[model samples]
Target: MNLRKATLTDYGVPPDDIPALQSHFRHLDENDKYNLLQVSIKYAPGIETQIYDSIVNCIGYRTMERFRDMPVSENDFYGYKRKTMAEYYHLAKLTGRL
Candidate 1:
């Protein structure tokens, strides 16, 4: 909520306008998602504890289904696994995980 300390405010978003920001974030690509995660952590530190954790848990479960349903090889599966883990790590860090 501290605009001066928040990276999001650099994008001209006010703290009171987070819902709209979140809606916009939902439509971004993977690279954009990762970038938003970083920006979100900088701007809305509490979101990791509040929203990011829940989203990571949900996406982690769904990634399994996606990987299985895909035609990728074991190596590719590992890549996806790593990416998922990285995403979780960022989320956890943002959320203040141990």
Candidate 2:
């Protein structure tokens, strides 16, 4: 799935998130980055919610509030949310669920 930059942007990921997305990319090898991006755009905005819930393993009213970039303390994973998103994509692949 060779995704265009515009494709990801069109998926509703805010432009401000590019830096965070790049940070996640920094942690991945080229192939893994491509795979995760493919899964991500395949699922689009909905995947944002799914990944947030999965990453936090929430069992309550945790909602997807944590997906945004907030103060470091308020953010889950302490500014590593994008990396966590990537992890969720990887997990989805392992389970063949996404």
Candidate 3:
């Protein structure tokens, strides 16, 4: 499935999050990115494990690629907006769930 379709069906994310999600998926197509940020806000140990597993298996080397490309500082405004979604992913891991 296309990114938009996969994102919608698998994660149930709203249309607003799509652009950001697509940016992240361009770098790492891992499901955890969607599940953690798009789904629940609460954290759980099981979710942490799931995120790790998904990241390790699906993201693989692409994680670095995506992270490196991620926006930092003001010059990259669009990138910064995209980074917000990344932040959600980070929060998911940090909180050990989501």
Q: lDDT per prediction?
A: 0.42, 0.44, 0.41
Judge candidate 3 at residue 81 and give its lDDT.
28
What tens-digit string does per-residue lDDT give for candidate 1 at 1-98? Answer: 32223243343445565454445434555655565456446533433322333243334324554543434443443333333334444453455431
Superposed model 3: Cα runs more than 4 Å off: 1-13, 25-42, 55-98
Q: What stretches of model 1 exceed 4 Å from their correct place?
A: 1-70
Clashes of each: 0, 0, 0
Model 3 lDDT tens row, 40-90: 223322234333333334543235345444222223322222233445555
- lDDT tens digits, residues 1-98, model 2? 22222233444455675556545544665565456555544544434444443333432224334444322232332223444454444454466533
Backbone steric clashes in candidate 3, count: 0
**How high is the lDDT of residue 9 in model 3?**
24
Show the colliding residue pairs in model 1: none
**Clashing pairs in model 3?**
none
Candidate 2 has its poorest 10 consecutive residues by lDDT at: 70-79
Best by lDDT: 2
Score candidate 1 by lDDT.
0.42
The Cα error of candidate 2 at residue 36, in Å, is 2.3
